[model samples]
Target chain A: MKNSLLSIYNIAKKDLLIELRNKDVILSISGFGTIIIFIFSFAFDVGSSLSSSTAAGILWSSISFASITGINRSFMLESENDTLEALIMAPISRDIIYLGKVVGNFIFITISEMVILPIFAILFNFSILSLEFITCCLLANIGFSVVGTLFASLSIKVRAREVLLPMLFLPCIIPILFSSIEATSMIFQGKGWNDLSIWFQLTVAFNLIFLIFSLFISNVIYED
Target chain B: MSNIIKNKLLTCSAIFMFINLYLIFIWVPTEANQGAIQRILYIHVPVSQISMLAIILVAVSSVLFLWKRNQFWDKIAISAAEIGLLYGTIMLLSGILWAKPVWGVWWTGEAKLTTALILYLIYVSYIMFRNYFPTGSQGQRIAAIIAIIGALDTPLIYFAANLWSEAHPPIVLGPASENDSSFSSNDMRIVWLFSTITFMIFFVYLLRIRYKLQDTISKYLTNT
Candidate 1:
């Protein structure tokens, strides 16, 4: 178990190093995310106090779109280098490699989200850098990365990978997307912790299910 | 699996459907609140339930396909996915038909409708993925993973949709909604029971036919 953990960490570290060199993955995520926030920023009055829920919806939908594209690029890069096949050929278990990619994807998206959130707060006139907000966003990002990694790898070989990725990814992520949006909205509205607990539980539970299921499914999909 | 069984299923499904139609029309008294339109429930509810069952079948068959590495399970999963999409379309259409008169709108973004629509979209995309992916074992494995995720997503979607809908009130409840005790008469129960049975049989027959078509096509291609 410790060895497996080490392997996962190593794979994640390797992925991070590669991402750092070109920075393509992070740039694509932030670029796409910024464009979305830019559109919403211009569409709504710059200083208008948007409804907390509307702000939450805008934040999440943009994240959803950007993160999916980010995931597609993450794997696309790996495939271009043939590293995915090499990793699959390695002695380490497939799930370990999958978990590694998920971790790498999560960190990349989170870093970009940090940059994106402040801009959204300024444009939408709502602060969301609070502890509760970060917690909710992290939970949602975990979900996005977990499900996205699996679908990205699965779709890499498809004829229409670009078009098909979002279609496959969105439906599966709806629960996480809604839970995080609602949870963050509640926090923005100054709702009690008791109310936020349900959404928290939902995001955590769905993330766990998708995480475990993705690991299990990875073994089969990655097999020779 | 055999001609005799298929024929038996076909005959029994026809007879039961006829009996269910009779029960829906003549046997169950007209609901005073909604009048004759309430009869759509007999078709809608059963189809909805069976459509959900089709999703479960897809998931289970997908799991078996991945575990056993058998094409037969893949065939079952694909067949169920196609049929689930059909039944979901029927459910949605019937719902809109009833909602127009009862709720004063063709559809509402209510919990039930929203959940059904999302679940239907999940399967539709699942079918679309199977179509877009190439015909190969790797494609089958990926599709199976999609099926499993889609099935497991149903309950979470229902729960989240329920929570989200509370912020926006649904239209006035039309009587004979599954929740309405007034609709729970012995007559209603009888009609619902037979209708569900008829639908189940029809589903089974359709599944067999779909599976056979798949088997024949694959066999023909291999021979050619």
Candidate 2:
């Protein structure tokens, strides 16, 4: 288990390293996210209507779409190089590979959310210092990336995979999207944890379920 | 040897379908509220239940195919998916048809309807992916992986509606909430039970035939 964990770390590090050098995935994801926020801001006049209450939804949705863009490009390197084939043939277990990709995606999206959240707040005229809302944003972002990465790995091999990943993923993410939006609303409204506990529990439950499931299937999926 | 068994199974399926049609259309009385329109429930609810069951069968068969490395399980998974898609479409159509009279719209932004629509899209893409890749090409393995990932939506689609506020049809069976009174009386209970069983039998009959059809195509292709 320790060896597997270390392998996962290395694989995750490798993914990050590649992305850093190319900067293509991160740039596009954050850029796309920024454009979406600006477009929505103009269309809905979100900049003026922005309250602590609605701020969280805008931030999370922007982050979610950004991550989808990043995940699509994250695999472009592997698809071009056959490096994924070599990784599978290595001594590492497939679960490590799955975990590595998920974690790397998690980090990538987290960065995007960090950038998007503040800009969203400023644009919407909401304060960004609420601790509870920030924490919820972090957790929800992680949950989304974990599931998104798994779907990316699964769909990146298909034809018109760009369209297929979101089609396959957005439905499953509805619950996460709901809870995140709801929990954020509650926090903005100054509601107590008693009112929002179910959403948090749901987020935790969904993350664990998808993590275990994705790990088990990654071996079959990654095999040639 | 198996030809006789196949013939017998097909005959049994035809009889079961005949009995199901008689039970649902001729015997069961219309509900008090929805009247003639409520009859669509007889078709919609049964087909939706069977589609969920068929999806489970597809998931289980795919897992078996991966574990055992047997083409038989793969073939079974493929066929079950085909049947599941067919039933899923019927469920959605009947659902929309039922909604038109009762909900005053052909479709609603209800969580259940949205999730079901997404489920249909995911599996449909899975089939499209399979077709895009040539037989015996790497796409078969790729398609199976997508099938497994898409199957993850089954549970999410089932529960998302309950977690979110929607105008979708309420759950009728199991631990009834304060809404239990809506389905009061022994007569309603018996009819519900009868309809559920009738649906299960009809599902099995369809599955048996679909599986044989799959076997024939696979065998014929191999022989040619």
lDDT string for model 2 (B20-74, tens) is 6676577667566656666566567767877877777777887677777777777
Chain A superposition TM-score per model = 0.97, 0.93
Using DockQ, give the best candidate's number. Answer: 1
List ranges where model 1 is wrong by over 4 Å: A45-47, B173-184
Native-to-model Cα distance after best TM-score fit, residue A154 in candidate 1, in Å = 1.7
DockQ of 1: 0.68
Candidate 1, A1-224: lDDT as tens digits: 99999999999899899888999888899889989999987798667778888888899999999999999999998878888889999999899999999999999999989878888877887867578888898999999999899888888778778888998788878888888888878988988778899899999999998888877767776867
- TM-score for candidate 2, residues paired by index: 0.82
- All predictions: root-mean-square deviation over Cα? 2.4, 4.4
- lDDT, candidate 2, residue B123? 79
Local accuracy by lDDT, each model: 0.86, 0.72
Fnat for each predicted structure, in order: 0.71, 0.34
DockQ of each: 0.68, 0.37
- Give per-model TM-scores: 0.92, 0.82
The CAPRI classification for model 1 reads as: medium
Return the clash pairs for model 1, or none: none
